[model samples]
Target: MYITMEPGSELAWELYAGIDEAGRGPIVGPLIIAGVVISGKCMNKLSTLGVKDSKQLTKAQREKLIDVIYESARYIIIAEIPPHLIDAYNINMLEEDTIAYLVSRIVAVNSHLKLKEISIDAVGSSKQLAQKIREVVPKSVRVVIEEKADRKYVAVSAASIVAKVWRDRRIDALKTIYGNFGSGYPTDPNTRRWIHDMYSLDPYNPPPIIRRTWGTLKTLAPLWYKKKRQTVAGREKTQKTLADFLPKI
Candidate 1:
């Protein structure tokens, strides 16, 4: 009573997919990778909807368009990589693997839509990334990897918006639990203070949310370590001074 369907065949509509990620550089929070597949007509509609690189849009603007994007796209997929995973794996390799997985997942789930091409905002070596993606997707599907493709392609823009919004939400949740960490970037002074404060609290084990392997920890470790030694030395000196002031037994 059921019909068997083969993937990537008997396509009714041709669609283009765009992939993007957020939170790659932040020393905190998970990495978010997103892909959007939309029909040709919907791609135009997305452009008309004022979709651009998520960086250009305000948080309010991105939130407003997120729903419209979901309604307009034929398919969308998002993947999250936690801090521990990122620390354990090479970032470039993790991104490539996630990109390939997202592409394959989209194809498998939306087999009816013939994906004509995929455009991604490249992480590194566009040529190599494109080759890696090409190996996973159908031959007919063109792979376009370029820096700032999010700004040039509406689909990529949509993906960027989705990824950004999701990462922001995750950061907000982390804030509720850990207090404000100031954008979670290593460059933020507040983030640096938070890292130092956390280190002071427990030098051995940091919160699970923090990327322990980050260079920030190493950079801050020595400073705190020195301070710790100085504090102990100061305490010992104070004790000796007190002993000398008191009459010996």
Candidate 2:
């Protein structure tokens, strides 16, 4: 005969988690933070979903897998930092802060779901980002930041999928109002041309969604400054020319 054990006999000790960001490389739109908590059993479910790096999956695939992963995972949290805040602080610091904030929120929401370990796709140097996270997060949680955690870790890949899907949806919504600005990354010629064209028409006017502090903004700055200088010079020259042409008074 076997003896019965107490309830909660199989309490999971170390919970594995993953965190990653999307829209960081984009010249426009907000940055998205995604965090996922996966128990050992849930890992097999993610593999069944064919969850991979967001970059590897097509838009349709990523969108489809998002719902699957959301349902399969133990917990998932996503947060966004709008372009204006990204502009207020540089991307590096903004991302660091966003990740820290997301992790804290996740812990608060899942207090019973004791998470002992977390893995993050590092935005900066792995060492630096990891240290920054530790400094901000409560002393209880242990975090490990790795360069390609999203690629190596199934949980991280799931987080990447959610972040990408959310960000792409936001971009699509913006396009409905603003038209197709392309992928929103600097590498996209269409995005660059759109920035150039918009600023050409009105230097002071920028699409409210675009990050004004980006290098693209700095590139446009010189043109606007040059035009301002030329306008001032032209006015000065016109005044001098008029004075010379005037009859002696």
Candidate 3:
């Protein structure tokens, strides 16, 4: 992808890449991460499209932008992590690693582009996490990770839309198989009600789609598993006590 730096002497990069994510909180669908890369030439077109944070836009607005991004961006990359991968690696760490890898892959593909800087809508926005991302990315390329970067940078905003669009579609697919649970957020009444119904029916084994490790499910454990845990604890304590060892002397 033959790219050149902006005409001005002050600019340093032939390409700019932005990274953002979606579905970090939803319980039912894969977490989607997206990166959008554009030349300085395409930046104005993106701005004119009025890109902003994905949450602020309607579903229709985001869908429209997705097409615009694909047409305008020099390169785009997406990563999706399912429940099993999320369960294996922590969500936050997984997000961090995924973002780092995405940027690296973009740079690798467009080596001639000479990326000036990478903009990221950081998942948790911590210094240590930012450092970890920097560690994996090429040192020649600068990385600027900020909270709410999607709202501030057009590239990041486009990535946010791409990620959200993919997540929404995946959720729709899940709905067909699992039935609608209203966005799959814990705060959603439909999701909560569904959890209650399913847990009551089979406390020992909830649906595999449910993230059993999440605190939302753990909070409900008192309803069924608490008593069994208590009984096991009581037995262990009694067996370890000096009085039990004395044997009715």
Candidate 4:
């Protein structure tokens, strides 16, 4: 879907791209990263596609626009980072890694075109995240990471919609097995209650699909970490006490 930035600004860049993600806040699904590339010439066409922030579009509208985006964009790339990796790396790192991965894919696709400018919705501190990305990205490309980029940039909005639509589909499929988990945000009491109940009955073990590293998981499974921490702390304390008591030469 084509979304236009408010008129009266000169468009400086030739090949502008936007990057965004979905499933970052959701507790139960993979994080999805998406990138969309557009040129000034095609901006009107994109606007014609009814592209706006994915949140603004109805499900039907989003579904309809997905095809249009695919057909019209110079490039679109999406990457899904699974739950186990999120548990291993932590969410912030996962977000960074996912962006890095998606950006790499965009670079690969644009390699033939020799494009320079790319924009991404700020995942963390825009400056820091952009710096981290730059450290990993090749020197030839320029990266711009900005806060609320999805709303400000049409490319970012398209990426946001693509990622959100993909993640929503994943969530719906998961509901078939796990039942209703709500929106999977910690703010959703239903999601929290479902997680608490799942762990209460199972203990130490969570459903295979749940992101165990989430704050909700940590809160519900305090004893799991507490016991482990206590065991280590107790061992260190005992070692110190034993050393004090030992005779020294």
TM-scores of the candidates in the order shown:
0.82, 0.78, 0.78, 0.75
Which regions in candidate 2 have their CA more than 4 angstroms from the true location?
A: 1-14, 135-142, 218-249
Highest lDDT among the candidates is held by which one? 1
Q: In what order do the candidates fall by TM-score, top score first?
A: 1, 3, 2, 4
For model 3, what is the error of residue 241's alpha carbon versus the real structure, in angstroms, after optimal superposition?
Answer: 41
Model number with the top TM-score: 1
Tell me how far the alpha carbon of residue 45 in candidate 4 is from the true structure, in angstroms, after superposition: 1.4
For model 1, state the Cα shift of residue 81 in Å: 0.1
Each candidate's number of clashing pairs is: 0, 0, 0, 5
Root-mean-square deviation of every model: 15.8, 15.6, 12.5, 11.6
Among all windows of ten consecutive residues in candidate 1, which has the lowest summed lDDT?
A: 1-10
Which stretch of 10 consecutive residues in model 2 shows the poorest summed lDDT? 1-10
**Backbone steric clashes in candidate 4, count:** 5
Residue 136 error for model 3, in Å? 3.8
Error in Å for residue 32 of model 2: 0.9
**Per-residue alpha-carbon lDDT of model 3 for 81-116, expressed as tens digits?**
776555555466567766766666777767766677
| Clash list (residue pairs), candidate 4 | 1-49, 1-51, 2-46, 2-47, 2-51
